[model samples]
Target: MKPIVAIVGRPNVGKSTLFNRLLGHRRAMVDDSPGVTRDRNYADISRFDKPFILIDTGGFEPVTEDRLLQQMREQSTMAMEEADVILFMMDARSGLTPADIEVAKMLRRVKKPVFYLVNKVDGDKLEHESAEFYTLGVDRFYTISAEHNRGVLDMVDDLMDTLPDVAEPSDREELTKIAVVGRPNVGKSSLVNRLLGYERVVANPTAGTTRDSVDTLFMCNKKPYLLIDTAGIRRKGKTVEKLEKYSVVDALRSIERADVVLVVLNAEDGVTEQDERIAGYVHEAGKACVFVINKWDALDKDNATFGLYVEKVRMEFKYLAYAPILFVSAKTGQRIGKIIASVDEVMEQYTRRVSTSEVNRIFTEATESHHAPLAHGRRVKFYFATQVGTRPPSFVIFTNQPESVHFSYERYLVNRFREAFGFNGTPLHLMFRGRDKKTLARQAHNPA
Candidate 1:
């Protein structure tokens, strides 16, 4: 799991600005759709040397002063509890306030490393003004302009150096970690039991390989898989009854550990708000996921029922357009075999790699089919594109006007790539960058 680094501060202190700045290119995709609050605040940040999850606690618009401060206090307290590292931001322009001191006091109590940040320090003058914050603080503060990228890199670099055990992607190809997560009693245990009873492996799992979650090694058609089920895992002194609500935390932990997630939904209940949030977390985490509608036997179906259900799911999870959905009954064991078959196929696409020439060719065709609209009176052009990484294949597309490229056009290019090469059950990241056409041409001719 990537370490979660959160930005917590009072309203209008540039928390969101710093969040967007840290995100860089991934910003657009993270804030893709309107009305998606969960995704808007949390982003999978990987551009930097040390990757982490960046959370913006300042998601709301400024309200009445008293209420906003109250909200900020609540937000800061919650952030301190959850985040691995906390970034306490104070506005250099506004100067230190009672709220900043209150938040600082809270931060002082936490065992985690709390970075004191004085934002909006645009110049040496403001940097000097930022020193007023030191009255309540013991350690030094980093003065930064989150909007202009001033002193932000230095702060992040120092924080990264201080943070220990950053979760880097493993090079070794090991057992595929599959997590089964859903609302409590949503047939999570039933499905896990069925799967284990059906395909539990002969040999015991090696020692010293256990995760915080309960993991069982199983085989499907001679292939190995390590099951990370949210249901089987129990927190100390927490009863199964309490787990209904508490399992959400466990589910998130399971997601962080798994490469692929099985977002199981109870057919009788249909799609709940919790289900959508859980699935949204999977998408946010960039894990290849499949939606399993469990207890399909309970739902009385007509010819139109399945289609209607599928359409509703598509509507709810508009962002997860790529994930494959399966209608299965863990009780009946109907269509059980299809689960692994689909997983195998999806993994193939999830870890798929397209050659640079082919990647550029598809983008070329995509633009030819629907030319990217001109932005700011200049014609937008794509010089070249190369698949940078795969685990949800990411591409860095060199373009003349990187900033001018519209989000819709980027989405169009993503659709085109998907059409040409099926990226089923996976998300695609297309990062636009500024590169000269001459440079691309030289590289193209040389064929590195």
Candidate 2:
């Protein structure tokens, strides 16, 4: 797992700006508006051949009653708790405020390593003013301008030295593979941070912040699992950068390798066509899938209304009617643990096997319920069925006329299999082949 470096401080201290600078792009939204980034932002950062996860905490405020403000505070506090090293940013131009001191006090209590970054120290005058922040008892301080990209590389170098080396798991075969995917800026990385108990990727407000496929491994309940954070998928015309173009391709490749894919969706936006397209890819790849409704705290829905949203999702993706849907607040770390349990359940289903007798029984009953279509006045005959593989639950069926099998008929059989044995959130593959030589000979000669 990558080391987590969290940027935390009072509002408008250039935390977001520094996050984007270290990430080598304008991923985080940069504006004069205080608390523009109310949610935690993350990105995978590398410097001098060493890599770590960077987190940009939302502006730290001293409010606890307002719901939204409380959510932001929780997100920032979570970042601090999970960080391997905390980058405590402060403004050199405006000097320190009471809020900054309060934040510093909180950081001092935590045993984790902390670095004081005095941002906006553009010239000698601002550099001289940066000294006042040393009273925060953070010990070391770095003077830099995040907007101008000055002294950012030095900070990266210093953080890289503090990161602990990641060790490989002993039982690689037992590792549960989970991929975090969604449309741009839906807190995919933020969710990843919660799962790994730290920030292993950088989160930003701007769309397409993550441009690489980052993998982090950790254990939940003594079972090791790998979490892959991927770039957001956008429509064809929306992508511009060469790096981003490759990143999208890499994200699809990660989906192919994943055992369970968590489709993260923004609760405020609801489901869209692009989301359906992404869901289609997971189904086509024959992988177990789960729907994660992120940022649920932002949605002003009561208990009854939230239930309706889940029902609507099931209606939209009828193919995955059996797949589980989890509503979570990545910002507040709400129900984040449930996401891991859901992935584990789906993975169990993916690797499950059925006996030959059970397979034949289900196939016979399904075929008897609705016979295969007639081909040239001859009814298609489906013979014995047997399990051939797992990790997608593949099967082979011998038939009198394999060519006569229709795609719709295959779908019906898959649905029947789901009904008999719970293959929730998992895709199934069925292969049809002729049992007799004459039937095979005819198909080979016709070449249709």
Candidate 3:
């Protein structure tokens, strides 16, 4: 299970702002109003290569039968109950309050790791004043300006060091990881909620409700897979707020860690340049990708019209022609099951293993079908091949002279491997190794 970190603090203390900063997105609604956030938001947060679950709790307001504030308090308490680490946030600008002391007392009873944070410490004066938070008895403290992003990285770095060095699951061996990525309000979280068969992830009509990359683990065909529901990714120039900028960064980071990325496009809006950019990131990362045309039920499609849109999407993202596209309605649960099954199939194909003999046979057939280009008066001889790894299947090809192998020929080999093996919706890696003394020694031992 991923480690859980909870952010708890009073209203207007920048808990949501800190949440946005840590997650690199404005997932939580950040307003001047004290009780803007009503529910606990959870996201899969990563700093560097380390990944952990982060929960953003609503502002702690004294309960007196007001339905919404009461719910907020309950959510904050629930977050504390589920947290592996709790961040007790206070406002350096506002100074300590009775509510802050109350929240600290509440956190003290919980037997989990807790850190005291003073937010809005943008300058040296506020940083010094933040030292007063030591009275809360939480030994760990970080002074940060979430809005300006001051000292945020230092806090993250310290958190990374404090995190226990637990054994992380290998990307290949762990259940297949599929990320849902797209622009704001494109129903990415809605799709995740449908897949999990419940409202595990909060889905709202408001743009950027799902702030962090929230992950939910479930079994498909008894194979464990993680579904990473990330914040909306907007184009760089379109981002006006510091929070939105962070959200985009978080979305891209989610794609970087995923084995397969499901790029959700708004069916009503068709495809946009932002969609193309998002798809580009997946292809550039060398990850298997699947295009999800969400809210298809709302689209006025008549048979051939859907086909045209698909073709258009393919044309727009020609580099990702290898990626498969699926249509679904997260609100109505239309085609949701098929989406899960397709993800499983793509993951299986991604991690598919091939025998050395089969690889050699296919190599021979491919070479005969399209001979390797001649270079420098010597015929480029591709002798043998073997599977080196999976999770984006990589192979090493033994050649007479590795340096003689042109990049175009390598692409040809990779295309041939895809044609023969059907590693659909996955990237392929090819490496050239010169036939040297080590190769001869291995051959001599085998004597075949």
Candidate 4:
């Protein structure tokens, strides 16, 4: 776990802009519109070899009766609560408002260090406009422009000195990271809370309530696992807000880092294109996956309903045919235990290794069943095959003509490996490589 640094401020005060500037990339959504970022978005940033988790949250709404605005306020407040250090931004152009003063009062309750940033001080003319902010009685402050990246590094230099030292968790076995990802309102957070037996993440009827990819440490049957509850991923066309766009990126990043990704689908809605797209990310990343069809209780169930729903998921995610599917109701705890069981099972296969002799035996049987295709009037000669890596079970085959090994033949070889050793709920990476003279000599002396 990295130290957390959160950015909080009133609406349209350039909080997101400063967040992107600090990240040195357009990760947080920025726009002239107020409240564009409704939820918190975080990323890992390293400066001068020091890494920390930087969180970009929605603008702080001091007082609002609107349902969404209140939710956004709660989201920002949560960031401030979790942050080791907080950056409270104010717009220099707008000078000072009662809302900013109220925000300052809110920060006063927080014991953590808060940095006052008067953003949009692009020139000397606006520098004087930031002086009045001292009325809030903050001991230290900086006049900077988040859009132009002016004086931003100076603020970071000071904040770096204040970051608290975090001790890492000492566990004998590495924690298994499981990322739960799906479209908006798909019961992702609900599933997380169910697994944790608590409301670890905010789960509402509203779409996109959980914006950030929040991680929670979980222990099940004496096994430690990190459950990453990610934001709802919207389609590119529907992701108009810059905040939501970055939220999607954050969710995808969580998937990339996960050992096993739980691709949650809403059974009430059936399988949609976006669900398949999310599964595509898991497949592309070569991560082990379990298809979790949530909201099963909401669907009208009959004798064949479960089978029909499973078939629908299979049809939509045909590429992920190897993944295990579980029909779970997050609201009712229906078959939720099977998710963890599947995760453990998949993880075992994900890191499974095969001996060189076993690999050769499987390869020989596969070739005997269906010989290699002929290229240039000669059969594509496969010399040796070995397991090069795990975590999706990677294998490399040394052949006379690597290019001559067609994709269908590669698929056949992968199927053979799966049949020999049940590589369930994981992808197989089979690489065809042609041997060179030096490599062939080395292999002759020390065979793979």
Q: Which candidate is the best by TM-score?
A: 4
Clashing pairs in model 3? 24-246, 24-247, 25-246, 25-247, 27-211, 44-213
Over the stretch 114-151, how does candidate 3's per-residue lDDT look in tens digits?
87888889899988887777787776778888899987
321-409 in candidate 4: lDDT tens per residue?
Answer: 89999989999999999999999999999999998778888898888889988988988877778888988899989888998888889
Cα lDDT, all candidates: 0.71, 0.81, 0.81, 0.85
**TM-score winner between candidates 3 and 4:** 4
- Per-residue lDDT, model 3, residue 142, is 83
Worst 10 residues of 2 by lDDT: 439-448
Model 4 lDDT, full chain set:
0.85
Per-residue lDDT value at 133 in model 2? 79
What is the C-alpha lDDT profile of model 2 across 408-439, one tens digit per residue? 99999999998899875688889998778676
Error of 3 at 286 (Å): 1.0
Which 10-residue window of candidate 1 scores lowest in summed lDDT? 201-210
Residue-level lDDT of model 1, residues 255-310, one tens digit each, is 88787889988889888787787788888888888899998999888999999999
Q: Estimate each model's TM-score.
A: 0.56, 0.61, 0.71, 0.86
Q: Rank the candidates by TM-score, best first.
A: 4, 3, 2, 1
CA-RMSD of model 2: 9.3
Over 4 Å off, model 4: 166-177, 193-257, 373-376, 436-441, 444-448
